[model samples]
Target: MRTLDHAACARAIFESIGGGENLVSAAHCATRLRLVVADAPKVDQKRLESLPGVMGVFCAGGQLQIILGTGTVNRVYEEFIKLSGLPGAPAAQKCTAPVLPLPQRLVKTLGDVFVPILPAIVAAGLLTGILDALGRALPAVAAADWFSFLKMVSGTAFVSLPVLVALSSARVFGGNLFLGGVVGLCMVHPTLLNAWSVGTAENVPVWHLLCFNVKQVGYQGHVIPVIIAVWLMSRLERWFRSRVPAALDLFVTPLCTVLITTFVTFTILGPCFSFAENCMIGLARQLSTVGHGIGALVMGALYPVTVVCGLHHMYNVIEAGLLSAGSLNIWMPIASAANFAQCGACLAVAFKTRDPKNKTVAIPSALSAALGITEPAIFGVNLRYVRPFVCAMVGGAVGAWFGTVTGIGATAYGVTGLPGFLIVGGYILPYAELLALSGGVAFAATWLFWQDVPAQDKTPG
Candidate 1:
């Protein structure tokens, strides 16, 4: 990236994508340069990828996104606006990405909301893993006062997820942050019976609203309900602020927002969306159990596709739910397979390529993949030779099949490929087996099927 001029990269993108005439809007989200273009078909994807500092390019949900990695996207985005000089598109309010269809938007929104909260979740997960490992070695360590404190530390995220979601989702939907926390707290109030306990108890307390018997349940580990609740709350808060006189706004806004949000969440949103959340969770769990190895194979194969579409982070929600429910995140091993397979595919390309320039790119890309970042390998090397990319997916599926049969999982959400060993949760033997097999299969497949690389591709810039 040091060799890549930010302005040059921006110009390359703008010129390749039909310049300001084509860009409907532009925005940056962490890594990707998210843009809404007039016509996706007009974009020259190869020229864009061929440019320095560019990682990958894909059109998904009607957005032409350039994956430029973190720390660099901001510079590129800034240069883009400065060069293009597009008008009336304020960075904050202007549509950055496409207005996706409702279902995709909903999933994307939920994933976006959870991403900010993942650091806490990951820390909690790792803490639990550490405690579990330590407890086995020293039984008395588990009973210590410090250990009790540590248990509370790790449990806080799962126990109070609503507040976390509320805090993040409120910001996402343009609501007052503190008020969102208030709404979240109302759902998980100390007086209320926990949401998890609702299923076990008979004849639980309820508040009737319309046709729905809204149970007085604490939303301890729920995600969707809190998000929907906060979104509604944000809208209500803004509406009140708009109608109320300026002098009374300070008092009137928070009061109406809290009252309406609390009543609506527990009564309507919580009870209703909880069912949907449960159904989603049940589906995920069902996938694991349906045909055992079949689930792992499917998840593994499709995992890379999600990465390609820039939607892989969505799995964090599902993984968090699985960890919160019990001991393991069964889906982690499937991801492990996908990641290691990419590494092997890239390495095979490095070994097979006759060109010095191709080898220069392929070797480092493979090493980067081994370290848990696959963008360089996927976009820079394996993807150039389409056969290797396809081989990697097949290898991922094969490896995950082994993982499901042996039942391995990871403790943390992010962390895979070779670094996956650090977070491997349930069993070591099976996890190692999965990695070994996934890499081996992908490497073999690439070597066997990807025997020919175009001469022109060998002289890559």
Candidate 2:
């Protein structure tokens, strides 16, 4: 084959596949370009994979991924979007389906909306874990003297969670990013917090009885309500933008949207959140009652798959529930160990693989996994190397089983990566020997299972 013109090839591939015009949504994880197409029939996957810069093509998780080398993927994705059209250019069409039962649809929709934000949540969890570790090592850091700075690092996402959701939700809603963020801010702002706080106060005046106690305190990084609020806000914003007179549109539209959204958030969204939290707690308790060994086994076996489909955020809710209830539960520790187990497995694959391309991906995958970001490892190495992935799962299951048997629990809910060990300090101090033993077993299993694969078997030939 002749040498390929990288940019030209990317453009041709995207154009051939119906360009960004056919996209309902687009996102990327470690190794794949994920796109939701308006018409899957219009796409020519064979041609796309055959393009000069393209490596492969596949559809997974409802996304048609056109695999490109790491460096050029983002560039190609940006150019493709530009060529297709910006959001609301009339080229993009919404998918239609028969109405689903309310509960089932809500559950599925929540999964989709929260997937993209998982990275940020993982980052926040990692930061919290590291800070917790540092505080334990040097108690002075946790004291009031250094409190503000530490809190800023740890609480940034939690406090400004609405903003993060707004950014992600903008892409999902096909609405203005800034406007969406503003709506999110309103949900989590001091005013709402103050109102809720006052209503719940012990000695509040009788006049306040007219105001409902929203009971929800922080909306930062909250999933269900903010997503619902943003979706509504986006629809309302789009409608008003189209119908309102241009002359008075700016002031009138925002004013009305804000007022309506604020009311909805306080009255409907906040209560919904409270109910969801209660449900999640109930579910967690139920899972815990089923014996930790069974719970851990399930988590270990399915954690990687959960991550692959971007459903891992669902687990974060469980962790958050544990935190809200004042102690860590069964999930986070297993999740953390499973992530590390994948890293160890990937590292073993890196050593076993002679393919330079696979080697390039494996090294970074290992590093990121250790740092608490395992997508690179999971996608780049483990998933690709079937044996390694299975090995990691087995390792995770073993680790989780050990932890559960020994009553291992996290003190906080966050990412389960290496840095997360800090969150285990006081909670598992007496059980350090057990924790170490479990980790050792996981590592050993990963190494044993991944070590002997031949170099020729590394890449998909």
Candidate 3:
């Protein structure tokens, strides 16, 4: 295989997106170069996709995302930044793309706040799964010093997830990350009772402030409250900075922001949002168990629809709530099923299609989907042909039912498909079966129902 020319690739991307003048700001994730351009219509998206080493291109949540895989995306991003004379760090860049509706904007904000921190969560989750497997398989080792050390390492992310969420939220909301971290830390302060222990704790400590009682409960394993608190902190900090005299701004802004936010958080945001989050968690749990996993079946089928709409990252909130409440991530299998089913559908397209171009795209896209990244397969192959997408959804629903009945769960989130094996613990066999069932069904269904339409005859969807 030929090595990618990072500088040339970046230059090509820069030109195709209408050069630096059209570029508003840029950032990159594990597998894609995310750009906010001055105008979406100015972008030569087709040219970008045709460029060497680019896997695919699409627009979602008011950003142009170009898929370039992992390490390659980073290198290309660095070169692109150099060419465009842009900052390497992502600042509070303003998007000029078409304004999204209120609900869509909220979903996009959740994606922005959560996407940056998913890597750490995914890493910790993988470790947690491995450690659990080790502890069960080697009971003696589970009691050793090394084992205890590993467990601590594995559990830190989930235990301190609030802090991580706050930091990311701060970045997204354009506030001081360190200050946001303080907000997160305050929520999980050692002095307060752990949120997870609230149900069992006989007597909970409370503070009487201004004719109201505030519970001294830590927000461990919670996501929404931390995000809201940090968002409020960001807004307050900005408001204070703008009005406070320059001489006193430095000291007064942070102090006022923290104190006021903390007061409102413990008294209002924490109680209100945590209650709402718990309700959502409860509802999700009920759905997973209702009518013999019928909820999972529905969710599994609908999961890809959310992805298409760029709303799937919101599931992270629910998954976090479940894990924080001391429950396994039962949601993982549904996602895995949905993703692998897409892989199966794409693979069938690759095998059945006579066109060399279709085969070339489908085979690698299917492999990518199998590894838990489905955008390439979904956008590049399956969705392009309507029948395959529907078939994959059916496969996902069936596989999800089977997985729910088997009762497989994961210790962490942000992983699915083959890499999921690392965190499924003892459910490895069941997960493999789940994959085979989902993929097999999708493959068979697509083979029977989907026809390879020749390029000249294919209609635009």
What overall lDDT goes with each candidate model? 0.79, 0.63, 0.88
* Model 3 lDDT, full chain set: 0.88
lDDT of 3 by residue, 1-461 (tens): 56889999999999999998988888876677888888779899878867877877888756788877767889999999999888743531345223677776788788888888888888888988988898889889888998889888888888999999999999988899999999999999999999889899999999999977998999997899999999999999999998999999989999999999999999999999999998988888888879999999998899999989878888889988888777899999999999999999999999999877677678878998999989878887788788899999999998998889999999888899999999899999999999999999999999999988776686422
Assess candidate 2 and give its TM-score to the true structure.
0.67
lDDT of candidate model 1 versus the reference: 0.79
Candidate 3 collision pairs: none
Tens-place lDDT per residue, model 1, 1-461, is 24668988899999999988988878766567878888888899878876777766766666777867667788998899898776423442246434566656666676778878878977887787777777877889999999999989988888888899899999889899999998889889988888677778886787776776777778886777888999999999989988999999999999988998888787767778888887887887777656968987888887788877657866776776676665578788888888889989989988988866566667767776776677767766777668898889998999988988887777766667776665664476788888889989999999998875566644322
Best by lDDT: 3
Candidate 1 local lDDT, residue 251: 91
Give the root-mean-square deviation of each candidate in angstroms.
Answer: 3.8, 6.2, 2.4
Candidate 1: segments with Cα more than 4 A from true spot: 1-26, 29-31, 35-47, 70-93, 96-99, 197-213, 355-361, 457-461
TM-score-sorted candidate list, best first = 3, 1, 2
In model 2, where do residues sit more than 4 Å from their true spots?
1-27, 35-57, 66-131, 140-144, 160-171, 175-186, 189-200, 203-222, 285-289, 319-330, 348-368, 373-387, 403-416, 421-461
